[model samples]
Target: MDERELRNCFGKFPTGVTIVSWFDGSVQKGITVNSFTSVSLDPPLALVSIHKEAKACTGMKDKAFTINILSDEQESIAWQFAGSKQEILEIDWDNKGISPKINGSVAWMECKPWREYDAGDHVLFVGEIQELHFEDLEALTFYQGKMGSAKQLVK
Candidate 1:
């Protein structure tokens, strides 16, 4: 299989940028992900797919985590967590809860670990949403290997 070609094909679909954050003991950790989605409404479940080798993959198990949907203006924040060499950002994190919440995200979901499954190259982490919040703001998006702002298709 042409792995690069497959990734290119998958990249054609636009996805919202997100940061999956959790705490390892007293240290805060996060990873940039675009593969976040709601799984169920009755139980209020959410999912974030993390690469099997990602540091967060091991640290996030059995822990509370937050899925922070980035605002369009937060591209730098996304890059910072994605391991870019840019200057470290003075991130404002709300630590009153079990997990840290990135301030200024368009939306955020605080979740308790529900289950995890070994996917092909990623581990699917499903969480039960305990609390969620959102703000009215344009979202950051990724498509075709580039980052951009989402377009408003309707009022």
Candidate 2:
């Protein structure tokens, strides 16, 4: 039972990078998340897994939030929210939606908390997508512990 090896194995799979943004009463907060996924089409549900200690998840329970799908050019923005970089993010915001949308993102979804569950060291926040915005841009990705540049694959 090698946890490090297991994490490496999980990292081998490519995943899209996203920023989960929420307001914590006093200020806006965001965190870079790679565990976001679509759960259902009929109900328009999505999920984002956040570590129990994430600063962004401080006051997110039962609240509205935004999931910003980052473009490859937004790697720096991701790093900023990830707390892996020192530079503060100076991004634009769209206040038209139920939540604040990150401007210049490849896509975004305003969501409301639908459900939550415990998952070992993380909590899974299932959100019901209320509205969305998107563009045809390459998405930022991660694989094998490295940031990846992935272009949109047309179907």
Candidate 3:
């Protein structure tokens, strides 16, 4: 199987960008992900697929986490977490919650670990949402390996 080709094929679908943040002892850690999705409403469960090799994959196990859905203005933040940029950007975090959330996200969900599944190259983490927040701002999105705003893609 051609991994690059498979990734390209998967990239055809648009996905909302997110920063999955968690605490590693006293330090905060996060990773860029576009594979977040709501798994259930009655149980208020959400899921994030993280590559097995990512630090966040192990750091978040059995830990509280926040899925910070990026706003359209947060492209640089995504790059920073994705390890594509060298310069570290100063990010403001809302630390009042069980897990700190990135400020200025279009939406955020604070969650507790629920379950984990071993997928091929990634691990699927199911989180039970304990709290959430949202704003009426445009979301950052990924499609065809490019980043853009939800509004920009709709047009």
Query: Which candidate achieves the best lDDT against the true structure?
Result: 3
Instruction: Please give the clash total of every predicted structure, in order.
Output: 0, 0, 0
Give the per-residue lDDT digits (tens) of candidate 1, residues 1-155: 99999999999788999999998887779999999999999999999999988888888888999999999888898998899945866888888687889999999999999999999989999999998899999999988877768673211
TM-score of 1: 0.94
Worst 10 residues of 2 by lDDT: 146-155
lDDT of 2 by residue, 1-155 (tens): 89999999998778899999876664667889999999999999999999998765656877899999999989888888888775665778776656778889999999999999999989999999999989998899888777758543221
Model 3 score (lDDT): 0.92
- Top-down lDDT ranking: 3, 1, 2
lDDT values, one for every candidate = 0.90, 0.85, 0.92
Instruction: Determine which window of 10 residues in candidate 1 has minimal summed lDDT.
Output: 146-155
**Candidate 2 local distance difference test against the native:** 0.85
- The reply for model 3, stretches above 4 Å from the true place, is 86-88, 153-155
C-alpha lDDT (0 to 100) for residue 142 of candidate 3: 93
- How big is the positional error of residue 110 in model 1, measured in Å on the Cα after superposition? 0.3
Better of 1 and 2 by TM-score: 1
lDDT of 3 by residue, 86-134 (tens): 4767899888768989999999999999999999989999999999999
